[model samples]
Target: MSAEIVVLLVVFVGLLILNVPVAVAIGVSALAMIATLGHVPTAFLMAERMSNGINSFPLLAIPFFVLSGVLMGQGGMARRLMDFAAAMVGRLPGGLAYVNTLSCMLFGAVSGSAAAAVSSIGGFMIPQMKEKGYSKEFAVALTATSATTGLLIPPSNIMIVYAVVSGGVSVAGLFMAGVVPGMLIGFLLMVASAVLMRVGGHSKAGVAQVPRFWPAFFGALPSLLLIFIVLGGILGGVFSPTEASAIAVAYAVVLGGFFYRQLGWADVPKILLIAAKTTSVVMLLIGASQAMSWVLTYENIPQMVSEAMLTLSANPLMVFLLINVLLLLVGTFMDMTPAVLIFTPIFLPVVVELGMHPVHFGIMMIANLCIGLCTPPVGTCLFVGCSVGGTTIARTTLPAIPFFLAMLVGLLLVTYVPWFSMALPGWLNLF
Candidate 1:
């Protein structure tokens, strides 16, 4: 670690401990480093880097995706997806758990926002699970953990962020690459929940009643089609990812307003305001992280850190393990957007040097960070899920353990097994 890196870490950590907002903490730390080094005036560097940070065309996809998620989430999509999931698995032993997991996965696939998934699916499933006799902590844990699979699924805002920061990894390829790994994690979560429920002595009495398969499927069909419209257009080269994002927003409006009749013109202002707020926060984080990345690069921090990690281990597996561990720790403390922004530039060079494909590493990195969203201190989904379930972090921590372990297991597989991340994109010739 260089003196500059030490200063950056100290200031950043100190600000975090003082309860400053994450974006502010990052920007302040970057500014402090510039002042300490006296290499460049703080204002000029901050202005240039921060403005350049959010100047990319690809970033436009983020706001569109966020708006679309808000639209679909409020459009009665969650209940219909729940019905469809229940129709698929609600009669199995410990069915409500399966329903919650499956519904979250479906909602995530369409909505492409993990927080939206947690709020929408958790809002419904947590209460339903409690009524079915599942513990509140377990319900929050399950909802929070399962919701993160969305970030791994297609049309993800975080994937757009990664695509931009990664320099040139195809957005469509990243989207395709994530499909199997995302589903794999969701399946692992479902199995973990089912097995834990069985071990905890939940009887068959908790099984839920679902509507007929055809009705449920047809009801959710409009919401489901948005997935194909957005992903298919991008993959087919009918549009770029940014164009696809706009199309997704259009589709979401049509589905929510006309097709479903759940969303009205009266609801547009609130949805836009919510989307604007989310987008502003995310863009600010990107700008701040960009400044941080620039400072790190100017100080040669990435090269130094990369060299240190490579010195620690010449073996690819060991180096990857070291990176994954660091990312997991970073995830616990930082939000995913800024983490992806700041670390992608630093760690990507090392992985490319090791011969790992950028798309594979992107999936691996996102999957690894998803676990952090369910952990403590700054786990976004954890806090949201707990609030939705009317529970506290302290109460939810124990029950969340198994699912956390399950995500860790999935992350290990994603890290070590290239096939899970590479198969789909390769088949599509997406590279």
Candidate 2:
């Protein structure tokens, strides 16, 4: 490796080890390497790369989607969706777990964020699960695992990032491709929850014995329409994803403030503030990552990595498996955003070389890394779920094992069965 590369790697690892925020870590490392090597003038390079990173028109979707998710979360749409999911599955064996999974899927469809799913659905369900006789750890495990669906559902900000980073692979096609696999993961998670409930001899007798479904159905209907408006509009070419996000945000605000009468005007500032903070974090990461990617490309790191992988695996299946292993390991330590930004460029050429569709690979990569958001060391959702359940990570992780296995299985299906990710895209003519 070149001296510059060695210095860059050391600075990156040092910043991470010191627990600096990821965006800052990346920026600082890139700046340090550039200064040390004098490869490019620091000020000019930073300005150029940062501008280019956030310059894409598609990136406007990020803040809009984020605001929409926050609006829905604070507006009581998440709770209503949970009620609807509970009504549909609350009578089943381990019904609460199933309800948790289903509710995450529904909320994910609208929010397009796993953290939002956890904060909204999880805050409501974790308490209910405990009240309904589910173990706190199991409840936390279920919520944390289910929250990952956010990355795969429509309006996903991560999908937008992937599209931007991958040099404009179709965002609409990526969105559609995620639907089937996202639902498939939900189904498998629910099944895994059922089996676990049976093994643990948990019963649903503790839940409220509600007989009427109409109220729940009616309450959830409006929120479901938001999904249609955002996703359907995008898929139908009625709106771009950016435009869809704007519409979705408007819908969420109206639903929360007027229709549901849950969120008041007083809540508006807080919602926007939260959304702005989140957007800043994501945008800064994108900016910093762009700088790092610029440096990596200059160093020919992606070419080197791709060539090395091609030498190791001529078979597509082997390449897929190897990538999964690599991602899973990285996911355990890193949050999804930086990981995707860093690795997508490195691995995408490998996928293209193996004759995989970029859309399929994008979906598979997101899903795999989403699993990491629930894993140990830096599992954001796991920590969030535990906070909601008032439990420790150690306590929740044991029950999380089965759910992790279920996610792994789902990942394998999406990775190998390209049809699962491609079918919806094909039908929609999104390719």
Give one digit per residue, the lDDT tens place, for model 1 in 39-59.
668898889989998999999
174: Cα error in model 2, Å: 0.9
Q: Rate the local accuracy (lDDT) of all candidates.
A: 0.90, 0.88
Runs in model 2 deviating more than 4 A are 203-206
Pick the lDDT winner.
Answer: 1
Predicted candidate 2, C-alpha RMSD: 1.3
Count the clashes in each prediction: 0, 0
Candidate 2's TM-score reads 0.97
Worst 10 residues of 1 by lDDT: 201-210
Expressed as tens digits, the lDDT of each residue in 140-198 for candidate 2 is: 89888888886787768999999999998998899888888889999999889888887
